[model samples]
Target: MFRISSVCLCLFASLAIADESSKPGRLTVAQKNGWATYDTELKKKEDAVNKACGSAVKSSYDRSTYPAFDPMKDRTQSACQMAVGTLVEVCRTPDGKAAVKEAVTKTVCRLSTEGTKVSLDGSVLTIHIDPEKSSIVGKEPGSYSWKSALEEVL
Candidate 1:
């Protein structure tokens, strides 16, 4: 009876340790800084893409009548394609590429606690919040609001 009790206690202790180890911990100072840097870089990229897309739309319409034209109506599939193309180009640089990769990895790490999965295809980023639901960013043209999505997730 004494040996059986000891074995059971050991198993219980191991299980507790395993569970604790699986839990996500707080980010370190360096990790926080890295995330901030990534956020800044992403913001810059978004601004650039938005500017380009805005210009494209503005140029497509007559200047005098532009005010009457609804911009939302212009945000079609082609506009999204252009935005994605611009995003792909912007991240083609070595520094931009590294920043984007690090951001995505960090986001995945942070969301792992909720069993979230993130995937990127071109500029369209998808965050699988759960098995039944997901949130997407950069999928819509003129809507490069990734920061908002990150805020919602965090």
Candidate 2:
């Protein structure tokens, strides 16, 4: 599971402008070896994420090494355009494939996105400046939203 860090607003004018649309309540999904979730306020939802990041050891993990993507094999590249640019890694242990089919056929993946790119393969989502443009790559099949879970690197 990917650990979510606290929302630290950088003195970066570029980031402030880019993330303005996302607002104070941004949600980040971490699908690393474990499962972790974080809202804009940095409140963790995963038990493991919390335990690991607790007043115990490492507070967070280096996202670059984790949430790896394989663009060559993923197929969920269509349903991720809603959140482009943002690193939207998906969990590929649940009904990821089914979710993709549903999201595509039903067109129900219209969530929050402003400066992100959409991408989906089999697993993983490469979110960017826009959530609408999130990309996807293949992770382990059966992952939660595998089509858009952990494919591209932000």
Candidate 3:
């Protein structure tokens, strides 16, 4: 009975995988080439966010306190995440991946006025995209990257 149950569970798991893969308009990370770096960086940024805000607690406070408790106190971590998260989410698509690569290449050329090799590194290049103007990602129109805003704190 145990062996039969194990086989049935495996069959169900396989079906679930197949069902997800067959869905339309979904881009699995495995389908994209050269996305490992982005995934790694995303994980790192997520870790940073967790480290920064994970310990935050809600406590009953007096209304007369000079400074009120901040619900989202770690704005810098939040912003950096918004930027990194948007880039990764958009790059899940084939077209988005190509567009981000092209845009980053152009942004590197534009920003390297001092002839520094700042953008030559893939991970470095990935961090500095104009979230507001990027047409590939379908984030909110008013959404902006908080990376620069929270750089010192991060």
Say which candidate scores most in TM-score: 1
Model 3 lDDT, residue 28, Cα? 43
- Tens digit per residue, CA lDDT, model 3, 7-120: 999999999999976655433454232234333444565444333433211111121221222233312223333554444444455655454444432111111112211122
Question: What is the C-alpha local distance difference test score of candidate 1?
Answer: 0.38
Query: Mind giving the per-residue lDDT tens digits that candidate 2 earns over 58-136?
Result: 1122233223323333323333232221121232223432333233211112222343333433333223222234433
| TM-scores for every predicted model | 0.37, 0.18, 0.25
- TM-score of candidate 1 to 2 decimals: 0.37
lDDT of each: 0.38, 0.29, 0.35
Candidate 1, residue 6: the lDDT equals: 100
The segments of candidate 1 whose C-alpha lies over 4 angstroms from its true place after superposition are 55-85, 88-154
Worst 10 residues of 3 by lDDT: 57-66
Candidate 3 residue 37 Cα shift, in angstroms, is 20
Query: Per-residue lDDT for 65 in model 2?
Result: 24
Candidate numbers sorted by TM-score from highest down: 1, 3, 2
